[model samples]
Target: MELLDLLLHPVRLRIVNAMFGGRIRTTTDLCRRLPDVPKTTVYRHVGLLADAGILEVADERRVHGAVERHYRLSRERARIDAEAAASMTLDDHRHGFAAAMAALLAEFNGYLDREGADPTADMVSYRQFPIWLDAQEQAEAVAALTPLLRGLAEKKPRPGRRQLLLSTILFPMGEVEEGE
Candidate 1:
């Protein structure tokens, strides 16, 4: 099964994003963090992810009469291969992008909803531009950006350091010209 397809759901994506800080969380913790999601719905998606091998069962314990299981990302970062994505229809791309955008917007709304969301404590920004680049430069740009992402994916924060989310989206600015 394509984990990408499974993660396309906003709830699971949000849960995965919530776990990014080298932190593991149980169902209850997820419920608290994802107040907009019904607890049962969260559990159903979490179970699906675990079954898909995208989420690992990190820890477990009994909470009252029930067992609580904590979960963490099975892979440090999400990846999809060309072959996997090649078969998707235009509708799939449209729906997937819309889902991702909605998830992003929800996170921004979450920050705003945080207690004591001080301007000094938060900021968000984005940039876009039309540009020209040769194939080599385009490849180089992706190469240059990969390490920063790998660092975010692999770096385990120390006790004193706060966890941070480093999200980036990059692609060629249109088809590359042989000479530009």
Candidate 2:
């Protein structure tokens, strides 16, 4: 299956979200963190992602006298490649976006649970804006975002540091009202 297809599944999307922000985790760790998901399901998702080149076995060590693999997101920044992105049907994009949103929310909830449920944290930011951009202008937004992602993709991981940044951008289209 395509990388996009693998990521479109909720279980796999969660697997990616769970591994984002330089978060390298083993099967056991993922199972512990996402207790609502069955261990077998987690493994299945991980395998799917790995097969699609979206996740990689970043490290290996012994657990239970056997090798436990630690997986990491291969995507330094998430993006739909230009050709695939341009040709996507509306329904394809819709389902993909919904799956992505669900994964992100699950990760955010996990963070809240871990940080004593703090309302303020250095790692969190949220904002919304009503823009003046036209539909054509909005279509160009990904071009602006893609360059930064490409730069991020080049940075090598450092020792004792898993630098994972999960970024999500949503652009909603609706009827535009004439200015008064």
Question: Which lDDT values do the candidates have, in the order given?
Answer: 0.74, 0.73
* Per-prediction TM-score: 0.82, 0.72
lDDT of 2 by residue, 1-180 (tens): 765677687778777666766678888888987877889988887777777778888989997799989888887333467787888889989998888777777767766777476646445676766666766786698679778876775566678755554565767557666782
Candidate 2 runs further than 4 Å off: 21-23, 59-62, 76-79, 135-145, 148-166, 178-180
For candidate 1, the per-residue lDDT at 91 reads 85
User: In candidate 1, which residue ranges exceed 4 Å CA deviation?
Assistant: 76-78, 171-180
Which lDDT tens digits does candidate 1 get at residues 1-180? 576688676787888877775678887888998887789998898888888877788888888988888888776334456765797788877777777777777776776788887645545555566666667997898899889877777767687775554556655556656755
lDDT of 2 at 160: 73
lDDT of 1: 0.74
